[model samples]
Target: MIRLHHVAQTRSFRVLWMLEELGLDFDVVPHSFFDRSLRDPAYLALSPAGRVPALEIDGRTLCESGAILQYLAETRGTLTGTPEERPDWLEWLHYAETVGSHVANLTQHHIILRDPAMRSATVMRLEAKRLEKALEGIERRMAGDWLLPSGFSAADIAVSYGALIGQRFTALDRLPKVSAWLDRLNARPAFQRAAARDGAAQIYMQAFYPPPEETPHA
Candidate 1:
């Protein structure tokens, strides 16, 4: 059975959601965020980064959320796009990873990482602006849905987690196409089941409402 090392509110959600899409039975291994237990020596053996969403599939371990999604999609053959379309496919993947990484960093440094007395104002503002630009770029590319010309591939899965979960940033209002895409993704039965299994409905709901902007630099 496929076992997913899941940490709630992390990129692991994307893996869980994809497993749901595949209709495959899997086990969810829980991990905590407050500590680096995930980075323990044994776990690190499987995932050098010591991050969540590591997968143990029939005794083979795999890490990195993006790689995990691509593996599952390829194994199940639901990954659309071919070698002829490889350029666009790889482009979409990079776009997803690039945007998501920037946004997540912004969220972490600006919002989640708090030491009110020692916060870096300049870093906060810079990350926020960078995140804004990244979102704008993503919106432009997604004007035509599904990331690539082929529609609904692992590329979408890679990007959707950030789009779906980045509540600390601005809402998806300006990016109506991406906003609509989020709604459409949530509507899928697979998404629903995965969310329920992961018990992430409340977290997903919370993501819909953006928190008040509290830029330390401002």
Candidate 2:
């Protein structure tokens, strides 16, 4: 049986969406970031870092979302992209983390740090800018509806997760291409199925978390 440890609105959603795209039958083991369940020993055994997207499949477990995507694609012989496009495919897959890093920092400052004093306005603004820059990269690279010229592949699923969630922290007003790409992704039947099962928002409750307004020295 394939089991995916998932937390709604987290990177785990990448794996969840991938499974749906592959039309695989799997079970989602729901988890919560606020509940401290991730710190438990049992869950820790599945994911040493106490993070989400730990997938159990083929008698082994994989924690990293990109790795899991590659494994599923390679083993399933689909969504791997043409052999000639492997280099671009790999680049986009790993680039997802570049987008994810800023998202994590923004999420920490904007949400996890409940106390206003504990949060840094500088960091929030900086990360949001950095996240915007990352999205800009995608906007520039997007020559077509998907990341690759070949067609939709796992790379789209991997990197689009950041764009989907990153918009919460960064504005997409200038990112017309990225915004359009997201609209296309959201319309996919598989993405719709995944969203239907993605449970409810636990981490990102706000529609937008703008950076703290800048202050001027008198």
Return the top candidate by TM-score.
2
Q: Give the alpha carbon lDDT tens digit for every residue of 1-218 in model 1.
A: 88888877778888988888777898998887667788689888878888888999856998888778777877788764666776776676667777677667656655466676655656656665666677677778773666776677777777877776663566566778777888888888988887777743322323332333554665
lDDT of 2 by residue, 115-157 (tens): 9999999999999999999999999999598899889999999
Q: Output the lDDT of residue 52, model 1.
A: 80
| Poorly placed runs, candidate 2 (over 4 Å) | none
TM-score of 2: 0.98
lDDT on C-alpha atoms for all candidate structures: 0.72, 0.94
